[model samples]
Target: MSDFTQQPQNQHGSHQPYPGPYGGAPAPQPQPVRNGLGTAALVLGVIGALAGVIPLLFWVAGVLGVLALILGLSGRGRAKRGEAANKGVATAGAVLGLVAMILSVVGAVIVFKAASDVVEEVDKALDSASTAPKDPSTAESGAPAAEETPDGKPLAAGDASVYDDDLQVSVSAPKPVEAGEYAIGHTEGNKVYEVSIVVENGGKKAFASDSLAVSARAGAEGATAEEIFDGDTYGKGFTGTVLPGKKATVKYAFDAPADAKTLTVEVTPGFDYNPTQWELTL
Candidate 1:
């Protein structure tokens, strides 16, 4: 018998030694797969949706929602193909993204509407004040003035006047006050004139304070006058909300040339095109 004897070879009775079954090297392990896009989409969608309620953040919310939608769809596709996890979360994210986008659009529309309303109010105020003669010179330009109506009679100091829907107005005569202890002096070669006015709102709506304006013209038979105060500034003119069926008294100070003779004071109630003028002899 040889030192290395063959194992039992029964069937073929071959003289070759029987070799054990050959085995190859162990196979490489697969890398652990990870997909986080689904979670990312879900988080962004939720945050964007919440932010949509804020007026200032609505625009940002819209952008984030769109991004979430894209990512969520991609994540959902991956989940369906078994390439990623969190399929339910991805679906929820997509839905939330759509809702956030819609809400954002609605919010933007509301903001624009509010802004439009404000602009309209401003327009109305401006229209109310448009009755003033643009070129104070028009009254003295050698052109014939409009025939003054009873309600539109020119006012002077201390005249009881009524105009535009029964609004009662009165102004004290313009008195010259030299800059002294009780008064501030007018600019060089100018005279300070003070007028006290009482306005009664007979209309149904509350008076818009912004609609009040005062303009002065040269009192001379042919001289022109320009606006000295528009009631735009506080303290110097009338300002504040006047409720319906209310009355307010305001004092006005005007500076004019010392020689301005015939002074006309025009009072305008807010939002009405027609204005009432009072003629006063200095």
Candidate 2:
């Protein structure tokens, strides 16, 4: 038999096995070094594109992209002289970061414009309904308005005043809503909670003026309530506008921390006013 196929005896003892496939050592891998500025550019770029994210991140991304591009171009020359570096990664980081930066600026401008439009719409509504009567604040007599429902409150009988009642806001689902389809949505890693509406007026004069002030229930109160936006309600394209004699539709879509089966929308008149709540499906 030829020696190539035969097992050989080791020095002074047992048989030795032949080496398997290409000698046994693992193949070498490309080492990954930290691409400093490149990494920063990439991170900033990702953050900048996020809607509802802090606007400053976009600026940071643009700045970092510039830095990465400069360093990468210069470093490419150094690498040929024996410096270990990642030219491709740095280039990509710079490009993506710039894109994020540009988009963020555009997004901000759009938001500003939308806000202006909202103000105008409110003014128009108020002017058109200027003849409608205004109601007293909840502080005036601690009473519910005629448009309000008990929802579960005891009312003292006397002269019936609609201003003494709590408003009825119900949130019903057309079925279960999947996430991300609504404005007030429920998704992981999102920043808002419990979107709702407030009817400044009801009946034909409920929206006494088109100049309405509508804002989300933000910060502390919302946090303490742990209320979240309903996927179903959000999907319906819920939006609120003060239309005298017409129903005011307030819509909210945001991301929340967990899954919920019940969500509520609270309506409050502008300024220090007693608010009302309407429930929605989670």
Largest TM-score belongs to which candidate?
1
Q: Candidate 2 overall Cα lDDT vs. reference?
A: 0.43
What TM-score, computed on C-alpha atoms, does each candidate reach? 0.45, 0.29
Q: Write the per-residue lDDT of candidate 2 for residues 176-264, one digit (tens) a residue.
A: 32354434334454444434333433334343323333223323235322233454544343334545434444554444334443434
User: Candidate 1: misplaced stretches above 4 Å?
Assistant: 1-31, 133-282
Q: Give residue 207's lDDT in candidate 1 (0 to 100).
A: 65
Score candidate 1 by lDDT: 0.66
lDDT values for all models: 0.66, 0.43
Q: Tens-digit lDDT track for model 1 on 59-170? A: 9789979988988898899888877778888888888888789878988998888899999999977755553422222232222233334433464555544443444566
Error of 2 at 23 (Å): 42
To one decimal, what is the Cα RMSD in angstroms of model 1 from the true structure? 10.3
